[model samples]
Target: MNRLARQSLLLAGLLLPVLPLAAQHVDHAGHGASHARDPMAAAIAAPSRTPANVARDKYRHPAETLAFFGVRPDQTVVEYSPSGGWYTEILAPLLSAKGTFYALQPVGRNLDGYKTFLAAKPDVYGKVKLVPFPDQLSLIPAGSVDTLLTFRNIHNMVMNGTEAATFKSFYDLLKPGGILGVVDHRLPEARDSALEKTSGYLKVSTIRRLAQAAGFEYVGSSEINANPKDTADWEKGVWTLPPTLRNGEVDKARYLAIGESDRMTLKFRKPAS
Candidate 1:
């Protein structure tokens, strides 16, 4: 063969392998860029979301809260005790195209409600997985989840005497450096821990201590759900606020004006080791 032809053949062999690698690099970078783009905006704006849930967005601040937790569409997430699937309505569809969302509910009457909600909305929720929340929390494998979220449910756990255990379970379920996003009614500062069992509100300091005791590092907290209007003292506690209005029609208008209870949003993480 001529020397020029030999040189041409050798050059073609060297370029072939690099072409595939260069294409792979581009695809990888593009995937990460797209993942970093917030999906909450589009998810919250989805046409399929329930109107009732949409109405609560003003108070719940779903988009801001999730963003604070650094939620992404590509992580394996577990929503602990998603009673009635309020956030589920947003999460299921948001993660439907890319990630896994487990609707982890405690074994109880509300289990059927979660099931029915997802069943009725297959297009957006069909990809969701229903996982039971047993007392031991063994349903999930240890160090398997990327994120664990709980909303307005910690007070109940404190009342039931399961708050510590629940936090420990959350710690166990997460992989190293995994996140735990917690949102709950906020008790006024200096409130006694004893009152947490009765009043729906819990002190942010107390919750942070509890999480730390469970081996979670306190990353930070947010006031996205905070309502300074909440005086934190009511004849009926937080239930005296809107939505619940435990007093019934006795002073409904006053409660409506007060709005929902002030809430604390916290983000914690398991140690990388």
Candidate 2:
């Protein structure tokens, strides 16, 4: 072949391998560009969130709680048993732009209510993926989630005798190095497992043991949701504190002063290996 023809062939050969990589970069950028500019901020500011939900920020500390778990704007997060979508209001909008938020619910009356809540606010919650968790968390795919969060729900799992299975499922669903953010009513001291069931309280030691047994490493704990005033020995357990005030308006003022239960916020991780 002539000199010009050979030079052209050499240039083409050098560029061939780089073509696929260039295409991949463009594809990734395009995908990311389609997401909201700042999902976390947008979610927090979403107008569709109910006023009552916003009012609870003082006790729930949604932003700080999620931050403690290292939740990123772009991640696949699954919230276990979002019965009333309290956190859903924040998560759906925050993740709607760039990440996936899965609301896992069991089969019950709350399921219909949860669906209706999402349907009513399509602009903010339309992207939320609802997974029917039922008994055993059959809906979550193994090693698919970056973060798995459960709020005040562990005691119920223990009460129903599915605690171990549920933890195992959580372990299975997370990617290696994935985070598990657990928030539950705190028991001042370790109590018998059965007694804990009735009190809606759990000891940090017991929680750590359970999570470690399921192959997760206890990374750390945060006091972002702690309320020192809560003695946690109410007549109706944690529910007697605020929101629930199981006694109705009997001690409404007292319970209102205490706010919500003193909760333990913990972070655990699946080993990267």
Candidate 3:
């Protein structure tokens, strides 16, 4: 080979190792940028959300709560019992553009009202797929979900004696590596466990046990939705707090000051195998 050609070849060999390093740097930088761009921001701030729902953001901490569950914008997600579409307002929009969002409403009167809410905003909620869960659990094929979430509804499951079946259904619906994100009113461990059936609050251990029984790995828990002011003992249970105020006008100011119920934010994952 000519001297110039040999020199060129030598130079190419020397730069080859550096090329991968440069590419790796670019990839790492891009990953960081992705995190900087919060996926839940737009959904949380969307104009379609009702003013009342917006007011609840302080207590809900939707973005942090969802992030703790590792929710993404490109996965199949289901929300169990999206009554009144509180999280629905955020979740449906978050998944509409790239992911599939299912509103798993039970077959009941609330389903009709939820339908009305979605119909009113076809543009935002138009892509939502509604399934009458438990009864219609088969509507979603087994092992198809990436994440299944239930917010503030497990107490009813315990009260109705369907908690086991509900957990089984969730386990069946999630993919082998799927996630279950749960947010519910927090019941102090020292408090009477029986209150779970009557109060809206639930013990974190109760959820962990049920989920573990369903074959999910206990991933972790977050305090994002916790409120220290909530004592979890009230005349009307959790509803005595704001939002429901089941004991309206009796201590309205106190309830309003306490705001929403203290909640436990938990994450569990289906075994990858």
Candidate 4:
């Protein structure tokens, strides 16, 4: 080969290796840039808390219940009667950067305890907002919330004679097409009368009717929190299980095995405009 041609070929061979290296570097950089722009990706990459990591000693189907509600990292969500804020510790951090998290405490109720609890966990719950409700849903602004969630709190309202107003309030707070997710202790169909007002259990059908009456369509139910072993009969009612274990230290082992009460996970949706 001529000297000029040989020189050109040598230069091309040396540049070929550098071209692949430069291409690889650009591809990696692009992938990192894309991930940085994705809020969900970033949240997962540095997850502050997950259901598996939280202390759910009394909550059943923690992960499945949340997933069925279609909770995202980018939506406004309000948790009703967030007693002690167990879920709040995880949720506030999860939605802090990408969404709004509101803890709706009932009005006239002392919240000094809750405020103190939150103050201790600034890193995870820094974005949380405390919204007070005046013992009624009318206090919630119209078309303001994207999602409303209540977990195992319905029975108390029902037994206390506040079920109708509570459901109506839930219906009003949701935006069109928004969701109202409820998880509550379940009462057997035939045992409704005997268990509804006393035990923590409520008939699933009753909940469905209430939701429908409040302008929400019953989407469906889930067995995520069902416990076949729970005969639904306990001396102290649903509180006989762990966390509450209201029986004191007696039969602690047996009750611990029973875990929390059997619950029903129900989803209802407000009509879309």
Candidate that beats the other on lDDT, 3 or 4, i.e. the better one: 3
Q: List the residue pairs that clash in candidate 2.
A: none
TM-score of 3: 0.85
What's each prediction's TM-score? Answer: 0.83, 0.83, 0.85, 0.78
Best by lDDT: 3
List candidate 1 segments past 4 Å from native: 1-38, 135-139
Please write out the lDDT profile of model 4 over residues 1-273, one tens digit for every residue.
Answer: 999999999999989999989999999999788767754444433455445435563355444676799887788888988867766755676589778888887765446677777787688777788777644445457777888899888988888898998788788888999999998888888874757888888889999999999999888888888887777788688888867889899999998787777888999999997
Best candidate according to TM-score: 3
Residue 59 lDDT in model 1? 93
lDDT of each: 0.87, 0.87, 0.90, 0.79
**Alpha carbon deviation, residue 172, candidate 3 (Å):** 0.5
Per-residue lDDT of model 2, residues 1-273, tens digit only: 999999999999999999999999999787566544655555666678889888888998887899999898789999998989999999987877678898988767388899998888887788888987755465567899999999999988877778887899889999999999999999977555556888899889888988999999999999999999998887678888877889998979988987998999999999999
Which residue runs does candidate 3 get wrong by more than 4 Å?
A: 1-37
Models, CA RMSD each: 11.8, 13.7, 10.3, 6.8
Q: Give the per-residue Cα lDDT of candidate 3 at 30.
A: 88
Model 4: residues with Cα > 4 Å off, grouped in runs: 1-53, 57-59, 108-110, 135-140
Q: Report the Cα lDDT for residue 29, model 4.
A: 97
